[model samples]
Target: MPAGVLFMFIIVFTTLVAVRMNSYVISALIIYVFFSIIGAVDDIAKVINQRKIAKGLISKQDYQYKADGISAGLRLFLYMTISLLVAMAAYKYIPNINGDINLPFISIVKRFPSLPFWLFIPFMTFTIAIFANGVNFTDGFDTLATVPSICCFVFVGIISFISSNSIWSNYLLIPHIVGLQEILPLIGAVIGTLLAYLWFNSPPSTIIMGDSGSVGLGGLIGILFIFTKAGFYLPLVGFIFFMEFASVAIQIGYFKLTGKRVFLMAPIHHHFQIMMRKSGLYKGEFQIKSKIAWRFHILSVVCLVLGLALFLKIR
Candidate 1:
């Protein structure tokens, strides 16, 4: 249902934006395709995959189902981390990559001459991945990942709007943007739909977003900023993603490197989920499962606010 609402919102946002922008038929069609189809395809695929498992068609369910409830947070985390590293490296050693959409959108601007892009990649990858995972990490339970994603996108998309127009860009002290404004409304609508989806997806989630949703969200975020081309700033925005992945990363690292397990389970959320019963965190706790999820909403909101302030100040 949460996924369905996102689909519907994408449709509405696409149609209105297309008409308002007077986009060419092809462009408008593409917009519809991206928002309506590309955005939702991952979720659909997950459903298909899960159905296969349910029907005993596929048996590889070990790690596949591990991140089910926490996928949205995880995907955005990793995609941004990897993407940021690539972008920074490209911006550094390679020749200038500036243009309309061709430019490395998110990484170090060639003109900035600040940090060497190459030098930034490792730090960027780890940091961005950590932060991105943080959002997921905070996603302890229902409505956590989806609700915050919706809010963050709305805020991030608005930044694009400020950049889209020269006047507003100047007023906001942001760069002038083109064609990106279209993405803002599209994202807004997508997230708006996601917001609606959260109504049904919150505590005791009826439908887990799974990795399909998380990774896709991260990918879309990369595309939106032209960051995918260069892989920049992922660490800054995707704080929550990195943290979640880090838990697993750390767990794996320790086990492999030191031969010890950190948490009884990885991702941290599952640890809490498991311990909740033993620790009495969920016993008659008005849906103990739900109480866990509410924690995510609060944490993501905190990360969102902090990330927004930093991004704007840095840019």
Candidate 2:
């Protein structure tokens, strides 16, 4: 089975079980499943194209599957649509949420009053799409995304549980979001699934989670933050993913304007790997071979720890 399919099954099964325990989690899971389906379809199309090429049924130059499986426009439309639906559902079901924007690191808990539905829907849709694609972009290397994801979800789960408990919310000066705690099991399920996926996806990866897994996982984290009123803290916890995404955007923008490559590669991690291989920073060949991925993973871990500590102290 494809790694994407295996991941989908595990998460879907876990979501189903979690729904039985807390039906509210189903809304978030719906967004996750939608992104996963988009990813799976794209993956399947890519596989078909690759198989055709291998069998001499299609010319490599003639293959369009890279761009044909689903157009970027269509994917963006779908992402926006699903995000709007989730936002609307939150509006209807969760009283007072009203798309409040919460800021991080003020002595007092600050919330910007709700935006109109029209503005809120599009604004939130854009935010979620950024997160989904940011994580998708970061999935380029083994364990590059998995460790950060695990850390984010674990902490988000803690935040959710705390936010749902009025006493804890009062003590921490965070909003007490009623019924948000029900999502804890769902978060737990994702964390567990990611842990299993990491076993196969670590260095010398046996299989990759692919875009499907990455986008779905990212969507889950994004929605969880929105639900828990911790959207501001997302940048803190998801700093690595945002950095990866930003590097690509910067590289592209600079190249388009100046016709010069910013880095040997984009997404930053690949740039590190390329630099390690080409720069001869290390005299030992074996050291260079091992250091690239290891260094990236170490940095990821450090960021995760920092994010966790920051959230705890702020909360």
Candidate 3:
């Protein structure tokens, strides 16, 4: 069973019970479930392909596309289209969710650089699509994506709490977005779901949160950043996910341009794994993986703290 199935249920149930079904939470849940459905389609396709291969009904080489889940091209198309629609909806329906954004280290008074709709819509769509893939890429390792995701939600929750209150927003010099607090329960539910996921996804994981969970979580996080007007802080709050995504992009781009590989493998974590294996310092796969997981977890924590301090206290 795809772990995302459980994640969906838990998040939905927890959020609904913990908070009133306000417009903010309702919109968030709808957007989250929409992206999750896209991911679930890919997951289901991969499972069907695996079963076919196991039964010798289809050759693995011939069905390689299916084995890898939905084709990358199709998945990208879906991501772009669905996220664009979501962005449009947010702009049209959500209050105070305009092109204005919050920047780190800048007073919110000066940071409200209002962008034109054309640019803002595409930017929002790009953010949602990119982070969805970023989390998906980071999910390559056990428990790697979970910590960072939890950290991100924690940041979003704090920012939302601050943004919803006039006094705190004024004190912090952040935007006072009405109804923003309504999404706190959703953020809390997501954090709780990830923590529950971590219990099983710790090193030597029994169940992996495949693309279904990763993509959904990533997409939701991206939207949360926008909704909270903290989109600029994504690079800091989601530092690990950004690095993972950047490594792959750099490796591929560099290889195509110069016919040279940047790392032993794409995704910095895998490069580290290959390096450790080559160094003969680690005794086995478990040790190398454990080291990587712990290091990334610590990095996520540091980024979370720095991001919060810079956004809230550094004024």
The candidate scoring highest on TM-score is 3
Candidate 2 least-lDDT 10 residues: 104-113
Predicted candidate 3, C-alpha RMSD: 1.7
Highest lDDT scorer: 3
Enumerate clash totals for all models, in the order shown.
28, 0, 0
Better candidate number, 1 or 3, judged by TM-score: 3
Question: In terms of TM-score, how similar is model 3 to the real structure?
Answer: 0.94
In order of appearance, the predictions have TM-scores of 0.62, 0.88, 0.94
Clashing pairs in 3: none
* Candidate 2 wrongly placed segments (more than 4 Å): 20-24, 61-68, 108-119, 282-292
Where's the lowest-lDDT run of ten residues in candidate 3? 103-112
lDDT at residue 152 of model 3 (Cα atoms): 95
Error of 1 at 13 (Å): 8.6
Q: Which residue pairs in candidate 2 have backbone atoms (N, alpha carbon, C) closer than 3 angstroms, thus clashing?
A: none
Could you tell me the C-alpha RMSD of candidate 2 in Å? 2.9
In terms of lDDT, model 3 sits at 0.86
lDDT by residue (tens digit), candidate 2, 232-272: 67777787777887898899899999999998899887787
In model 1, where do residues sit more than 4 Å from their true spots?
Answer: 1-141, 225-237, 284-286, 313-315
Over 1-315, each residue of candidate 1 has an lDDT whose tens digit, in order, gives 334334544645564765455232223233233323333554566666777778888766643763243365554454454556454554453332232221222322334333344454543444333433354344445665665566556556666666667786555344464555665556755675676667767555677554334434543443444421222434444444555667787898899988999988888767766777678645564465576566755766676666555445544
